[model samples]
Target: MKKNIWLDGLRSVARMGETAVVAAKAGIKYATEKPSNAKLMRETFESLGSTYIKLGQFIASTPSLFPREYVEEFQGCLDQTPSLPFSYVEEVLASEFAGRDLTEIFASIEEKPLASASIAQVHAAKLVSGEDVVIKVQKPGVETILYTDLNVLHWATKILEKAVPKVKFASLADIVEEIKTRMVREVDFIEEAKNLEDFREYLQLTNNQAATAPRVYHQYSTRRVLTMQRLYGVPLTDFEIVKQYSKDPSQVLITAMNTWFGSLMMCNSFHADLHAGNLMLLEDGRVGFIDFGIVGQLNPEVWSACIAFMDSLQKTDYQAMAENMLKMGATSKQIDTQVLAQDIERLFSGVLMADPQELLASKPSDLNDIMMDMVAVGERHGIRFPRDFALLFKQMLYFDRFMRVLAPYTDIYADQRLQMQMDPSLLLKH
Candidate 1:
């Protein structure tokens, strides 16, 4: 035990020294290049590898807590890490499926990965039964590396928070903790497989056929390896191709939105990450929802309040919206609803006043600015939103971006097709 402790101490010291060297290099680059802080920080995070890449993705997804520039810049964070050799992929699969005959389990797995990301690589394969599937294989030692890098990042965040007290409002350590929790879950393919199953159940229970999530093959899946039905489709972002799949892209957005909203009320958890890449127009005409790694759950009260908030917003009832937001967040501190309403009105008035054409042409950062401004106003009014709420809001922004391309002139909020009512049983059970 003593020897193990000594080795760990040495490893920690080495990591700290390495971090210092990287920091020094980043400082020198910033000093010489004088690039924008957002650009410099993004470059530094990219160079730092997986943990930082995940952090960048977190920042991109959660605009409520980040500055618009940093959020926008990190949206470009690349997840396409170079693929490991096929030997490593096979070794991972063998370890995951120990005691099982590989030949009987899979007829063939393509040696080349269909996609490679920081945490896992995906390969197309054919099952023994002749079903086409995709295998998501976790990279070797990713868990160890993730924990090590996160610990180092946690330590550095503490130091920086101490040095710069003003940054505390953003809750740097808390953000790191949130990221750690989510990323740790992300690396667990079993949990993700469960999420996929839950979503599939939601669709079946609701009798909804407009959207679908990948079907997991639990018999062949393990903690670090996921086997799922391979989906072939054009990404929703490819508007031209998506148009070929659907005559009306506006209905596509509506189906996606309604299905997702229903899941928030019906499922155990909602897909927290619904970026454009994860949504596709499948060949069979159903909208495909993939990548169930990051998900969020809301308590009964929060879900009810969210529904009320949406109804209030649609009616342009700012006071009702403020009250619903406060209820959703549930702060113990005394808050004046009238003042909150005024603040929300002031914040949204600019958005309401913007010309439709200009709004459609605006970038994601522009939408983020409006959303973050509302968050800022809420903060001033003692309204603290739950992280799930932030995730949901970010998804709304994503849908807004999609609408810009799919239906430029449509009013998504006013669409009659979206049914916000919930069955009393679903609302009461939780």
Candidate 2:
């Protein structure tokens, strides 16, 4: 045990030294070329590997806390990662199922990965029972690298904040801590399996037949290997294929939105990352929600505040929106609701007045810009939203983008199908 600890310590030191060299080179290049800071940071994160790649994705999703350019730049950080060799993947599977026979557990697992990301690679497999599935296997040494990289990142954020006080607005240290908590949970396949199961249960209980999450095979799953029911489908972003699957793609968006909104109230946690890749149009015309790695849990008070905020937005009640925003966030000092209302009204009125067609043209980024503007204004009033709130808001923005593509020129706020109000009975049951 002591020798293992010593080896780990040595590895951590080596990783830190390597990171420092890479960062120094990137910094010198940035200083000389005067390229956009967002581009430079994105490149640096990509070069640094898993932990930074995940961080970049977080930044991309979190428009509520990051600047528009940074958020836009990091959007490229989705799942663009190099794959590990089949031998390494086989080694991980053997280690994860040490005593069990691989042939007994899985009839066959494809040598080539179906997909590869920072932490894991997925392979198409068939079980002994003749069921098709996918096995998500964690890469060797990823946890150690994650720990070392996050420690270095946390340290760097502290130093940067101390050097530049202006960068302290969104609280970089708190964000890093939040990332650490989520990423740590992400590496644990057990928790992700639970998330998938819970979501599946929520769908069953609600009789939501239009949308589904991948069914987890708990018997074959472990901390490092997750075996789930294979969902064959094209991505939701593949509009041509989606149109072929569903006659009215607009209804697909509606079904997805309603199902997701129901989960917010019914499930223990909500899917925080609902990018185009995570959502798919299945072979049977059902909307498939996959990738339960990152999720958000909101307390009752925050959830109530969120519902109220959405209700207020539908009604254009800026005062109510401001009050709910205060309820949803934390601050050391009190803020004036009236002033906050004025600021929100001023920011949103222009967005609300824009032609729907033009808004649809911009789609995702337009809504992101509006949310960022609101965050900027809220920051001025000393209102800092919780991480959960930001996650929820980001998902909402994603839905808004989908709406533009599926139901062009539709007003999401006033849509009759959208249940903006939370059901009191559902709240009590939860």
State how far residue 202 of model 1 sits from its true place (Å).
0.8
Q: Over all chains combined, what TM-score does candidate 2 have?
A: 0.89
Per-residue accuracy of model 1 over 187-254 as CA lDDT, tens digit each:
99999999999899888877778889889999999889999999998877767888898999888988
lDDT, candidate 1, equals 0.82
Q: Each model's C-alpha lDDT?
A: 0.82, 0.84
Error of 2 at 158 (Å): 4.7
**Can you tell me which runs of candidate 1 are displaced by over 4 Å?**
1-21, 161-171, 354-363, 425-430
Could you tell me the lDDT of residue 44 within candidate 2?
91
TM-score, every prediction:
0.88, 0.89
Model 1 has a clash total of 0
Which sections of candidate 2 miss by over 4 Å? 1-10, 61-69, 157-172, 300-304, 350-362
On residues 97-211, what C-alpha lDDT tens digit does candidate 2 reach at each position?
Answer: 8899999989999999988988999999999999999999999888888999988878989899989988734488888998999899999999999999999988887777889
Top TM-score: which candidate number? Answer: 2
